[model samples]
Each structure stands twice: as structure tokens, then as C-alpha cells.
Target: MRWAPRGCGGTRPSPEHVKRNGWHDQNILVVSPDDQRLTWPERELVRQLGEKLYGTRNISEDRNG
Candidate 1:
């Protein structure tokens, strides 16, 4: 239940992201970013946040679960 903005690759970014990601994370419960089981919202938010943070829209749930 965390958000790292893709390339940021950190545990938890901000409290807001934590809250948002956490909400979705529970559904996904990714042991790592490489696991795949994220919800649609989780995936969308991650991708959006990733692009915002990394200046690229490459956030992928393909790796995260």
C-alpha cells in the first residue's frame, strides 16, 4: 500500500499517495512492484503518478501485484 511515482522507486512517497495507494494496495497487496494483481484504479493512479513524477507515462502494473 504505497506510491513511488514509478521511477522514484521508494517505499512510500507522500501521505496522500500512501492513502490513495494504500486503499488500492489492499486489493492488490503487492509484495513488490513486479507482482501483478493491482486494481484498475490502482493501476491508473500509479501510471498517472508515475508520469507526473518521472515525466513519463510508463507506470506499469505488469510488474506489481
Candidate 2:
């Protein structure tokens, strides 16, 4: 599956974010920002990165995204 943030209008993660998050572009990692497996800083960074790449979620688009 393609890698995209869950609530960020399906924008793909940046290469920098991928490496920082220890992910490869072809890897599929679906985790919530609140996932217990992630540290607080990491979760926060995920949110920040999602926002940086996609601004914010569009409720309308989310129905299909």
C-alpha cells in the first residue's frame, strides 16, 4: 500500500520524515499518533510532519481519502 498520513488528505510522507521515522517509502506502517508504541516526542513529530505536508485535514475529502 502507498504510504500516506491517515488524516492529512492522503499526502505521502516526505523522504526526510520517512528516514526520521525509520521508515522506507515502500514500507507500510499504519499507526495512530497516539499509538502506544511511539514515544511522546515521536507522536508529536508525526503530527507536526503531517501538518507541515498537508496543512490540515479536510473533513469533506476525508470521506473518500
Candidate 3:
């Protein structure tokens, strides 16, 4: 399951939903500026890391699988 840090202010998929889909990893994606108010360089780093781990697809794309 993917989750950004707190204060991101979005409706996250419920843990039960993720569990029903068999995704149990606590995969935290640093995709929000609210996470430490990341600087440009930090954001870039997070973006690269996220791409490496989760790929560049839209999150919805993964839902079908």
C-alpha cells in the first residue's frame, strides 16, 4: 500500500481495501511537499526514488492489477 506522509490532505485508500487487494507493504512515497516541505533538490531525490520503487505509472494504473 502506498501512503504519503501526514498532512498531505488526500483521501487515502483504506487499509482494509488495500488488504483485500493483497497489498500489505507499508510503502511510503515521498510525493508531497508537505513532507518536510522538501526543497527542490530533495523533491527531485524523492521523485527519482519513487520512480525506481513504484515506476512512473499513475497510481490508478496499479489498481487494475
Candidate 4:
């Protein structure tokens, strides 16, 4: 699926608003039916977005290596 802003030619999901507030439920990456994994880069991206969405920011990183 493609996620581009209305007038941005359906580019990748890299909107300032999205980058700052993280991706919407529809945009969050899904690893499995029950597990969700966000990379370090993605984590930071979403953290900023969550802050804007909820007015506060809180993210718990689950490292598995």
C-alpha cells in the first residue's frame, strides 16, 4: 500500500506531522499478529509523533538481540 499526502504524489509516509506524531494505527509496522516491532529509527520517529498526538511522550523500548 502507498501512503502519500493528498498533494505529495503518494510518496512514502514521511510527513512532518506523521514523523513527529508517529504513524497512525494504520501505519504502524506489524511483525506478527500478536507482536509489534519498531526499529531504533522508527522508535524515535514514533516517539515524537506520540508526543504530539497525546500531548506527552512515553515509549518503552524492548530490545531483543
Give the best candidate by TM-score.
2
Q: After superposition on all CA atoms, how large is the RMSD of candidate 1?
A: 13.4
Model 4, which residues run further than 4 Å from truth?
Answer: 1-36, 58-65
TM-score of each: 0.33, 0.41, 0.36, 0.30
What does each candidate score in C-alpha RMSD?
13.4, 12.3, 13.2, 12.7
Q: Give the TM-score of candidate 2.
A: 0.41
lDDT of 3 at 27: 57
Best by lDDT: 2
Name the runs in model 3 displaced over 4 angstroms.
1-36, 59-65
lDDT tens digits, residue span 1-65, model 1: 56656677846577656656866867532232232577766777776665666676454646456
User: Model 4, 21: alpha-carbon shift in Å?
Assistant: 22
- The residue-by-residue lDDT of candidate 4 on 1-65, one tens digit each, is 46766787844655545644545645653221122465666666666666666666333566453
Q: Sort the candidates on TM-score, descending order.
A: 2, 3, 1, 4
> Which residue pairs overlap in candidate 3's backbone?
none
Per-residue lDDT over 1-61 for candidate 3, one digit per residue giving the tens place of the 0 to 100 score: 4876779867788765765455345653325422566788887787777778778846556
lDDT of 3 at 24: 41
lDDT of each: 0.58, 0.69, 0.63, 0.52
lDDT of 2 by residue, 1-65 (tens): 56656676646788658755765655655555656788999998887777787786554665554
